[model samples]
Target: MPDLQRTRDPERWDEEEPPTLTTDVTIEQPKTIITRNQSPDIAFDRSINAYRGCEHGCIYCFARPTHAYHGLSPGLDFETRLFAKPTAAALLRQELDRRGYTPAPIAMGTNTDPYQPIERQYRITRGILELLLETRHPATITTKNHLVTRDADLLSAMAALGLMVVNVSVTTLDRRWRAPWSRGPRRRASGWRRSACWPSAAYRSTSSSRRSSPHQRP
Candidate 1:
């Protein structure tokens, strides 16, 4: 892998501030979007990752190592460099329309976050949800970003059909630890309120601490 870091001359280092790392996104046109898995340890058989790298920068993210496959550092580069699948929804539509296609619950955010920061611009995940809703297909989403709530309309519609479920992962409630650990996801309170917007939808919480539990608005 090449040096992704920006270096400065020794004498100028004292005079100039260190360069800041910025996120860069590369568009990838994949022939297919759905990934099939048959691992007995996994709960879902198929999954879709709208983005390749997660901006959340979770220290313990299992997907970090995947960046190594692209000749990039699995540390900082994994968070700064990302790949988006703009054609995912189109490809998925084709796959769903295939003659012998079978419908099962497609999973999102299994490898990387679908609603990561970049999704705000690309809106690839939202397109996928629209397609799924059109086809009346089932899907399951797991995310740490509150951006997922932006699709509450789609989610609630699917939920009314008993076709959608969401899992929100909360690593910590304390901002002191959370700020340094997962750099992008919002605070627990905000995420809880946004998640609650999905009426009648099945919501689950995954947390490292037992103290972090699901908060329902009654």
Candidate 2:
């Protein structure tokens, strides 16, 4: 809302730079990071999201609807396109330092996965976690990617101090159902096929099948 230009002169709009056709980089300095929550089932009051769109390209993604506000096509743009908050780490630390700041657990990966692929290069989320670790602030995270493993040292240290927890979401354990959903992403993106929801071959090789799809609600 802060950067948007409001003008009565229609011609001025034409001179504005259009979003790039495809980008692996985007830098936005949001004014705030900790979003207040009112959900009854959630356990935290604030959350931080490092990126605006996910490139995972999973069709069932519930966050896909948010792309419309950016005038982007939620279909392909949500995958090939993305947004980054390079200043989020600094903003978060400032917020946590506010005069009356009370330290309550902050949640990450609530609305968007912090470790989503672009994070490898941007490292905004990593910077944020480092700040939280240094402050000894309690936090919780839910993510489906193994990238979190890269920060295991921080997480393990936080866990030892009773300041952090992680919950990994695995949508399905079915081989056939998971296979169809997984294949569409493999050809376009490398390094993802192995982590697809289907059981690792090692697991499949060691045990008998236990997959079963549930009946749909009529």
Write candidate 2's Cα lDDT for 109-178 as tens digits.
8767888767888888789889998999988876666676667677767877878766555444443334
Q: Tell how far residue 136 is off in model 2, in angstroms.
A: 0.6
Candidate 2 has what TM-score? 0.69
Stretches of model 1 off by over 4 angstroms after superposition:
1-20, 179-186, 197-218
- Candidate 1 residue-wise lDDT, 1-218, digit = tens: 97698688797667432345699999998889999999999998999999998887777788899999999999988889999999999999999989999999999989888888789999999999999999999998887777787898999788788788777776655564563424333454475576564532323334543444454443
Best candidate according to TM-score = 1
Residue 212 CA error for candidate 1 (Å)?
9.8
Model-by-model lDDT, in order? 0.80, 0.68
Estimate candidate 2's RMSD in Å.
13.9
